[model samples]
Target: MSDRIVESCRMCESSDLESVLDLGSTPPSDNFLTLEQLNKSETYYPLRLVCCKSCGLSQLSYVVDRETLFNPDYPYESGTSKFFRDHFEEMAASVTGKLNLAADDLAIDVGSNVGILTAAFQRNGVRSLGVEPVGRLAEKANMAGAETVHAFFDPDIGQKVRDSHGAASVITATNVFAHIDDLNAFVETIKILLKPTGVFVSESPYLLDLVQNLEYDTIYHEHLSYYSVAPMRSFFDRHGMEIIDVHPVDMHGGSLRTYVAFKGAHEVSESVGRYLANEKEQRLQDPEALKKFGAKAAAHKAELFEFLYELKREGKRIVGIGAPAKGNTFLNYCNIGPEILECLTEKAEAKVGLFAPGTHIPVLGDDFLENEQPDFGLLLSWNLKNEIMNNLSAFSAAGGKFIIPIPNIEII
Candidate 1:
C-alpha cells in the first residue's frame, strides 16, 4: 500500500467510497521521460479507480497535482491525429451553424490542446480564444492566430474572462471536463462565463464505452472522473444549467458531446432524455455495473498478455504502433516492455526520441516499421486504428499484423 493520501469524491467530497478496480501502482500516463531521466529510479503511485456511491461518479483515488499533470511542456498535440483535427472541424461547423454564430461571436475553449478547434472557428471569421494552463500549448495556439490565455480556467479566471470578453457566446471543453478536480467550482465558472442564452459544450469519454469495451487503460491520473448522463444531468441541474443536447461522437473510441445553457434557456433536447433513459435501462448508476466491468477489464488484461506471450513463444517479434497517452496506460497496466514489445513507434517528434513513461520502452520514429518490420505491431492508438492501418501499409505489405486490444484482443 502506497501510504494513503486523502481521497474524496470530486462531486460530493464523500470519503465513503468503494474501490471498483485497482491497476496497482503506475507512473503518470503522460510523463514520457528523456533517456537520462529514464535511468533514474522512476516514481510510481498506486492507481485505484474508485466510485462514489453517493454521486455515482467514477474516479481515481490517487490524484496527481495539476502542475505535474499539466506541465508547460506537456506534449499531447491533438492535431497530430489528422482524424481528430478533421473531426473537430466538422464539430465547429455544426455547432457554429446550429448556434447561429456571427463573426463577432466570442467562443472560448477550456484546456484547448494546441487550439485546433479554436482555429477552425477562426477560419469562419469568428473571434475565438483558448484558455490553457500549459504554456507551450497556449503559446502554440496564439501563434496559430487564436487568442489564448495561458492560465487555468478556474472560477476566478472564468470571472476575469467574462468581465473582459463579456460572456462567451459558446464555451467548450473537449475531452477535458473529466479531468477537473473541483467539479462544483468548474461548473460554477461555466455558469459565470457564458451568456444567459449561450451554449456550453463538453465532450468526454463515455462510461458506457469504458465499461462495454473494457477500456480500463483510459483510467489514469489526469482523468479524475468517468462521467455518465445520469450523474452529469443531476450535476448540471444542481448548478442551474440544463443539458440541451447530447451528441454521441465516435472520437476517442466513444464520447458524449453534451450541450448546455442556463436553466430554461432552451427546452431540453430529446437527445438528453433518450441518453438518460438509456443510462437507466443499462443500469449505469449502479455500483454493481462498474464492479462487473472491472472484472471484464481484468479478463481483457489476461487475454492480451496470453496472446502476446503465445506469439513470443512462437518466435514472432512484436512492435507497438502509435505512442499515445492511453497507450502508456495500457502498456504500463499490462506490464508490457521491451520483452513483449521491441519498440513503440510514434508520429510526433516530441515523443519520437523519448521513452514510454514508466515502462521505459524505447519510442522510435515510424521509419523503424519500414526498416525493421516486426511480425506484429500492437496498435496502441487503437481508437484511430483505421487511419494508422492506412498510414502503415508498407509494414503490412511486408507481412505484418496489427493487434487491437480494446473492444477485444484481436489481430486486424
Candidate 2:
C-alpha cells in the first residue's frame, strides 16, 4: 500500500466520504507467486472502501502503486476464452456499425490486453491502436494485428498518439476505466485523443450489481472505484463530456456498457434516464444502502466459510476452479488456503505453475482435474460461471459438485 490514502472521491472530489466495506489487508490479486518467488516475502495492502456522499462513487480508500500492479508479468489475456473472443468480435462489429466507421476512421482501446478488441477492429478493416501498460503483453500484441503503445494512458501518452497516429474516431475502454485512480486525467486524455465527433465508450462493473449481489470479492487493490450512472453523470458532465446512453450487460456478473461523447456530439437517450430512475429506486447513493450492503457481504462470507469448513471436517476434498485475480481476494479475505483448498486450476499457461498470493494455494493446469479430482470445486472465477459450468460437465456428471459462492452460495 502507498503511504497515502484518498481523502476525497475519485470522481467528484467529495470530502464527505463514508466507510462502506473493509475486506482487510490483502495481497495484490494478480500477484500469483512462482515456485521461486514463493520462498520470498509477499506484499499486502489494506483493502477498504468508502462511498463519496457528494458524487455517490464507491472507491478504494488506499491507492496501490500502478507500476507494481501492472508489471511486465501481468498474466491476463483477453483471448483466454472463446466466449470472450466471440464477444469481442461481436462488440467490434456492433460498435463500428453503430458509429458508421470507415476504413480511415481510427479506433483506440485503452488497457488493451493482447490487443484483442483492437484486433477485432482491424479484422473489420477499421484502423486500430492499443495503449497497454504491460510491455511484455504489448510486444505480444503486435502479432495480433493492432499496433500497441506500451505506456500508461494519460494526457502525455494521449498527445503522443494524436501526434503520431492522429485523433481517434472511437475511443473504447473495457473494464479498465474503474482501475484508474486519477480519473480526471483519464477523462482529459479521452478528450485529447478523440475527434470532435468521436465516441468514448467505457464498460465497467456496475456498483449496483456489486452491492446487490454481495460481490465483495471484486473489491480488490486494482479496482479503485465502483461507479453508477448518478456519479458517472456528474463526473462526466464536469469534464465536459456527457453520458449519452447506458446499457446493462451480463458480463462481469453485471456491467454498464456506457456511451459518452463531447457534450453535444450525440443525443441523450431515454436509456440514461431509465437507469438513473432505477438507481434511485435501489437507493444506490444512500449511505444506508451501503451499510446494508456491508451487512449482506458479511453474511455471505460467513455462509461460505461455514460450508467449506463443514466439508473439510468431513474429509471431503476441495479445490478451486480458476486462479483469477478475484479468486485471490476471495481466498485472502476468507483466509482459505492449502489446508482447505488443495489447489487452484487455470486454463492460462501463464498461471499454471504459479501460486495464489497471500493464501499460497498452488495453481495447476485445468487438465490436472483428471489426475486428481477433488470432491468439490469452489469456483473462484464465478463471474464466468456459465463458461466454467459448461466446460466441467463431466465433473458434474461424476458427482463432483461445484460451489458458487457469490450472489448467494449454492452447491450443485
Candidate 3:
C-alpha cells in the first residue's frame, strides 16, 4: 500500500484513538523535486495527528510507505550543519564516559545518516558501525572512514551485525526512533544487537515542547510519533527495558535524550520521575489539552499567514532562509508558494537546485541572499535561528530583515 490510515496505537495496539490536529493533506515533506520531476504528479497523504487514550502516545493517523518516504534520493545529511556535528561529538563523548565504554567496545548507530555520530564514536575511542538504509549515504559514510551497513535495520541485520562485530556496548538512534513504524520490532532488534548490560539511547523532539511551543510544523509523514515520557516509559517496560535517565536538550526546538537499558541493569535517575511528574501536571496525555493546543495552532497559522500577506502587499520582497523538511510542512500548511516566497536559499548542495516538495518554490544557494538582497527572509529553520542569522550577518548588514515564524511571528 502507498499509504493507509492507522487503526490502532503504534505502541500499545489500542483502538481508543482521538483526532487532535488535522493539517489536511500534504506531499511528503522531504521529497525535494528535481527540475525534470516537477512536471510529474505528486502524491499527497493525510496529515493528521491523533492521541492514543490507552497509552497516551501521539502519532500520525496515516502511514506513508517507507520505500517512498526514504527514497534513494533522500537529501538530508547530518554533517552539513556544524551544530549537529558538535552535538553528535558531544553525544559520543557523554555516552562513552557515562557507560565507561573502552576501545574494545562496539557502538552502533541506527539510521546513521552519513555516519556523523558513528565517526564521533570512533573519535571517542570506541569501535563504531552505522546502519543506514540509503545506499548513497552508506557509501558516503564508508568513504569517509566510517563503516556502514546499507539496509533497513531489522532482527536479521541486527544478528548479522552482532555476528560480525560482536554485541554493541551502546546503541544510539538520534532523531530516528520516531520514524519507525514498528516499535516492537525495532526494540527486538535492539535486544538482539545490545549486550546484556548495554544501553539504548534515543533522542527526539519532545511532544510537550511541540504542544507548548505550537510547533505544528514538525508534524509530518516521516515522524510517525510525537513522543512523551509516560508512553515511552510504558512502551519500554513492555519490552523488558527501562528508562534510566532523561535529559532535555536545546535542539530541534526542544528534544529529550533518553537512555534505556535492560530492567535492573542500571540505576534509574531522578530525572525520569521528574519528567513523568511534569507530564502528569501539564495534562500532556489528556485529549482536552491536546485539543486546546490544536485550537491555538490554528489561530497562530492564521495570524502568521496574514502577517506575510500584508508584507507582500506592501511591496516587500521575501524569500525563505532555509528549506528544511519541517519548513515544507509550514509552507504547505500556510499555502505560501512562490507567489509569497520568490525562492528559498539553502546551504546544502543537495537541495540548493531542487524545489520545495509541495510549494514548488525554487531553492537557490546561500549566496542568493547577498546577490539578490530580498527585502525580508522567512526563517524556515527557526529552531536554528541564531546559527543561521549569525552566518548571514552580511544580509542583515545590508538592511535585510528576517521573519521568525514559530513560537510567535516576529520580524527582526
Candidate 2 — which pairs collide? none
Worst 10 residues of 2 by lDDT: 1-10
Can you rank all candidates by TM-score, best first? 3, 2, 1
Q: What is the C-alpha lDDT of each candidate?
A: 0.86, 0.89, 0.94
Instruction: List per-candidate RMSD values in Å.
Output: 2.0, 1.3, 0.8
Give a tens-digit lDDT track for model 3, residues 211-322. 9899999999999999999999999999999999999988788999999999999999999999999999999998889999999988988998899899999999999999
Query: In model 3, how large is the Cα lDDT of residue 236?
Result: 95
List where candidate 3 sits over 4 angstroms from the true fold: none
lDDT (10s digit) by residue, model 1, range 1-412? 1233546767766787888888888888888889899768877887887878877778888777878888766888989988998988988888899899998798898999789989998886678889999999888888988888999888899889888888889998999999888788888888888888999998999988888878888888888888888778777887888889998899787999999888988888889889988887887767777888888877888889889999999999999998888888888878788899999999999888888888888999999999988899999898999999999999998899999988877887
lDDT tens digits, residues 1-412, model 2?
2445899888878799999888989988999888999899998899998888887888999998988899778898888987788878888998999899999999999999899999999998899999999988898898766799999999999999999999999999999999998889899899999999999989999999898888888898888989899999998899888999899877677899999999998899999999999999999988778988988887777888888999999999999999889888888988888999999988889999888999999998888776777799999889888898889888787778889998878988
Global fold similarity of model 1 (TM-score): 0.96
Best by lDDT: 3
lDDT of 2 at 155: 97
Per-model TM-score, in order, reads 0.96, 0.98, 0.99
- Poorly placed runs, candidate 2 (over 4 Å): 1-3
Between candidates 1 and 2, the one scoring higher on TM-score is 2
